[model samples]
Target: METEDEAVQLPFVGSFDRRDGADALADKIIRTLSFDLQDFRRGQRPGAPKGFAYLRERVEAAGIFVLLIGNLGSHHSALNVELFRGFALADPVAPFVVINDQDSDTAWSFTLLHELAHIFLGQTGVSGSKAGTPVEIFCNDVAGRVLLPAAELARQYDLRDAPQAEVISRIAAIAANRQVSNSMVAYKLFREGLISHEMWAAVTSLYRQQWLQNRNAARVKENDRGPSYYVVRRHRLGDRLLKLSRRMLTEGALSPSKAAAILGVKPSNVYALTETAA
Candidate 1:
């Protein structure tokens, strides 16, 4: 992590004077552990490996948990209340990352990076309320810097003569690189004074309303999809348990009934609840 003096030399716009000592420490830790977005997006597996135990090991090892809080109103999917509650109760001291899908892909990506900033800053047990605090403000500043560096944005602004469509196109290009949304880029540009206040307000208002409507429609679709269950099993159980169980069944190390018993599932539901990686 760079010192305050060093951070100023970086592409970020905000100052670090807002942060206290503890917050600064958190920031350092986050910066140290941070991984490239491109690498992570490509490397991440599509689903939970094997079962709950495997999931815990991978998350604990990564030192961060990615919680995708989908908008219930738009998708009709039930809120992941259980997952949220579990994290809250599990460890008050450990770092936790939480992100909300506020309708737009752009908004969601910004919020996700914002939460990652909080993790890097070393704050624990954070939520939306903490966003207003000095530490959180610093974190937000860092996230913005990372997602849309001041230098790059300035170059883009120079390339256009303030035409709304041209500005949107530039923002879209930046968002594409960051895997974020155009609205997020637009807001960033507005904050930097590259766009007029009136333009900013109008575009933001329109985007917000559209996002709300789409989110509500998604909620209906989710409700129609019916029940889906996911479990968070003990970490000690590990991915090996799932793999070994499958191998044993194949090699005649154990009977199907015995494997089902060990896994604590009925014979019929074992296939549904248990999956082994190849």
Candidate 2:
């Protein structure tokens, strides 16, 4: 539970109960900041860079923090609880912590964006009280509006007497288009009485089981590969920095050591950057 003063710091941004509502907050934030969300969704340069290091740089630049929340007993996993505490300690004012549920990219994306909405609303110190403090409730409402717009979702779901599978398919399609998860869409439908609670629960359970199975399979594959470090993406060094690096490399404005430091690498790795450019 949050104190009255703490609760007052949070702002309500958009509709949270409906399927399309959750995305509203993010949409509003993007627009307010004069940023095009499409720009963030684009592909990076091939073989440019990888790993969470790039992501961390982007988050720092954007004043956001992404925390990966994985299953218990998973080695090298990010713990959500620890992330929450860390963010609280690091930046008490407007700490932005995005949580990924480690279930699937879809779920992770949805939850991350939803949490981002909470940060945009200026809500902090939100404990896991599902009965949720007023501020939490308001944040949830904003998340709903941002993810599922009421009018838009209603129009899409208003087709004649759709079956559960059909409805789920449609919801899944919409979620995919919005870069969110289908379960989030179904949850919204159940909340709106578009789907029964039992149906929603059953679908959720199935997805959970599937996700667990896939994760186990992936673990086996990782074991087979031994210890191999994978670079996920590299363009995350900020567009400005990336351009500057390239220009400096051509004009000799940046030395190899300076370039390595800019990329968050040790001075010894300076050759790596030059080698890549070579």
Q: TM per model? A: 0.53, 0.55
Best candidate, TM-score: 2
- Per-residue lDDT of 6-109 in model 1, one digit per residue for the tens? 11221111223334543353344335445343443234333332222222333334444444444443446644322321111122223444444333444533
> Residue 217's C-alpha lDDT in candidate 2?
93
Q: Which 10 consecutive positions of candidate 1 have the poorest summed lDDT?
A: 4-13
CA lDDT for candidate 1:
0.48
Which residues of candidate 2, in runs, are more than 4 Å off? 1-27, 33-61, 69-94, 126-137, 158-163, 223-278
**On a 0 to 1 TM-score scale, where does candidate 2 land against the true structure?**
0.55
**Candidate 2: lDDT over CA atoms?**
0.49
